[model samples]
Target: MSLQDKNIAMLYYGEQPHPAHTGFADAIGADFICCNPRSDGSKIDSPLNEFFNGFSLPDYDIYITEGSRPLYSGIAATIFSDSNLIYLGGDHRLRELSLGGFPNQAQTDTRYLRTRSKILQFLCQHFIDGAIAVSADSATFLQQLFGSPSTVRTAKPYVQRDVFKSLSTLSTDLESKKVAVIASANRGNVGDYKGIDMLVDSWPDVRNHFPDLKLEIVGKGHQAKHENTEGVRVKGYVEDLDTVFESIGLYVQPSRLEVFGVSVIESMVAGVPPLVTETTGASSELKGIEPALVVDPNPESIASGIVQYFDRTVAERENIAKECREYAMSFSPDVRTKIFHEEFKSLIDEIQ
Candidate 1:
């Protein structure tokens, strides 16, 4: 029943493999394969369908992939026919667990997305031997969706602490006056999910309290909405996040729905304190480190948290920054691989 001697493979349909997938592959010593299921890479069909369209799946004792399934009309049971399928469910958002059976704003926004969400709901309720969630909040959501608490396991994404962490002591002047939000601001799904508009709306109030405060909006897509916003700078997709983190005093992820905010973790690793929304999957990490930093998802609440952070003495803020770095260090790639190897062994044995 143990995976110690089993053949495992992690299949991801893209040019790049997710860091979490790569970490899991290392944990179980699985073959990590980057597969392009569709030549054109359109989202019309599930990756599973496209994967079968052009690629021949090799047999392995265990098969791992992101939690994706063919649509109701698409091919369903042909792929991974004889192997144990484990879903990496950490990367996607299921509705907020607290909103159980209730329609939230995100749920009601898009008919297309709602249909897709229903399909995933059915998959979790009926299929898959196990689901791996990266954060405790996500694990709880999967446990509910899987309807079997034991089938859900918690693991973390691999963070490149070496590249993301602080290269030197953080500067007080730089960090104290600046805050960065790194999610994409593309209109519709990308913009709405990240609550970029809300963050921008809140920036003026925060600046009103501290006139020198500046908000840096990073990531790509049309950011014209932020162009005239006072004291806000839009840096579209910088190649150097380490440099970005080094320059900021605070990081904020005002996400309406994020499975796990990777940038939030990156900022923590770089010795910058992060203020995240309660719904953010990474808030599970922040709550344990500093409860006050996890604010409600709204302009007023987010602005309040930012104001509170800037309210702290420089020495007090620096102390929190140090704690953030220390806490995030536990999730570095090497440490997580070792932890996940043991955890996955237990989880697989239980699943068998």
Candidate 2:
């Protein structure tokens, strides 16, 4: 599996942490190269762009476009430049454009449709071999737009070992009375999206039951200060999330919708009990994992769930924390890498 022997090219938006790990795997033994034009120099240099600026790609055995739409459009032209093409996630517009399909009259006037049409044209010219979407919903959408070749519903790949070891170093003493929520503040109003408002509303009720509770809101967002709450604190945009997780007893997410809750997995890895929404992808993954509570985004439910856990004895809490840690390891990098290898090979075979 020498890098030169594998001869694979990956197309993505940027050198994100997760995709970079996969790229590393591919580079070790396969002719693995990556292209991420959207990566601004502000974060990290675009490795693929740097390598391919003067290099060619027709020599590669496979070309994998990471996601759909805007990101995929840049790679669409390269499809024709490669021997075989596989979309990591289905491209709805590309699928439709490949088949000469057009949207309804209402959508025809929108700029989105026009841009999508151009994207589709690029994809159609490249002659895509197949697609692999991360979720069943995404797969179905791809099937409708482009027609399915082969599909696998797997959790978005993550770096589990790194996250787990970080969590292991965190203090898990329940007596610390620390509660934490890791989320993007600017995503929505504190009351609307992350359910921070719901959490705030439920605080009085929650405090009625467990007065010792202290909260740490991680991530930057526009949240107003609450004068009355005793122990609630906000540490916006933390550099070391592992250290932040150390003092927390519970991880709470009240998001209305999430493709996959990476934070929940991070929380579980850090040995923190999660109280999240059922709509979250991690909810399904964490089901039956003790102390991983699921509740609606309502104030009453969130408060009640928090109280239920607070009522648990110290030993009981420790047991639940242990279960969470064990379960989190299932998603570790080694395990996910194995899954990625198998799926990537299977997809390549099916497409070829």
lDDT of each: 0.72, 0.60
lDDT for model 2, please: 0.60
Tens-digit per-residue lDDT, 227-298, candidate 2: 256667767788777777777778887654444566887877777778887544466656677534887657
**Please, what's the RMSD in Å of model 2?**
7.2
Candidate 2 weakest lDDT stretch, 10 residues: 98-107
RMSD in angstroms, candidate 1?
Answer: 4.2
* lDDT per residue as tens, model 1, 94-199: 5543343322354444666666667666776665677778778788878877778988788777676455444334443435587888876334335467778888
Residue 320 deviation, candidate 2, in Å? 1.6
Residue runs of model 1 more than 4 Å from their true location after superposition: 1-4, 33-48, 51-56, 67-80, 96-122, 164-175, 184-191
Position 172, candidate 2: lDDT = 64
Question: What's model 1's TM-score?
Answer: 0.83
The CA-based lDDT of model 1 is what? 0.72
Angstrom error at residue 301, model 1: 1.0
